[model samples]
Target: MAYSLDGVLVFGLLFVCTCAYFRKVPRLKAWLLSGSGVWGVFYKAAVIGTRLHAAVAISCIVMAFYVLFIK
Candidate 1:
């Protein structure tokens, strides 16, 4: 398997963004969770041959609902 420096950097940035955003803005917590859900499904599809775009999209949709209706 080939090691990807770009992939490592992307994920590293995502992790740092998650940590920093969670600490500064509480509202972004839900949005970050939604984005991470999308990332997880995407990464799983890339690494494990899983097709879960619908699930990831739904997660984002539900989060949108919470942002618009609940929050």
Candidate 2:
């Protein structure tokens, strides 16, 4: 796979998975990270994503590995 934006995206998702696993993101409090507006949208997504970390993480790894091995 090309080490471009796709790589960055995958790495970011994996990072999010790690953060979500440790409950470091999607904070319930109304602070800077979880504030309203654009961050709010992200926070909401993170809330759901963190709850489904297992499925998300597994699928991401599977897809990445599949792409890597296919070439």
Candidate 3:
């Protein structure tokens, strides 16, 4: 199939949501939380999730499906 910017955008969004969803998984969490100094701490804080992350992931996945199937 031919690839377009829409495909790339959708893939990029899904990738982000996947990272967000997986940020809490044990090994990934350690890796995701791993960084250095202030950046490390800030990185963990940024990736650590509340339900908002799930919502964002769900919405993005839905959008991804729409883009892939409909658009």
Model 3 residue runs over 4 Å out of place are 36-62
Task: Give the TM-score (vs. native) of candidate 3.
Answer: 0.49
TM-score of 2: 0.52
lDDT (Cα, tens digit) per residue for candidate 3, span 1-71:
12887667565555555665556577876666466775474344345433367766686778768867887
Best-matching candidate per lDDT: 2
Candidate 1 colliding pairs: none
Candidate 2 residues 1-71, lDDT tens each?
A: 34776677676676556545534634434353453777765565566567887888787887688668953
* C-alpha lDDT (0 to 100) for residue 4 of candidate 2: 77
Model 2: residue 8 alpha-carbon error in angstroms: 11
TM-score for every candidate vs. truth? 0.31, 0.52, 0.49
Q: 46 in model 1: Cα distance from truth in Å?
A: 5.1
Leading candidate by TM-score: 2
**Consecutive 10-residue window with the lowest summed lDDT within model 3:** 42-51
lDDT of 2 at 1: 32
Segments in model 1 whose C-alpha atoms lie over 4 Å from true places: 1-50
Question: Ranking under TM-score, best-scoring first?
Answer: 2, 3, 1
Predicted candidate 1 versus true structure: per-residue lDDT over 26-69, tens digit per residue: 66544443445555543333322224435544654665575478
> Which of the two candidates, 2 or 3, achieves a greater lDDT against the reference?
2
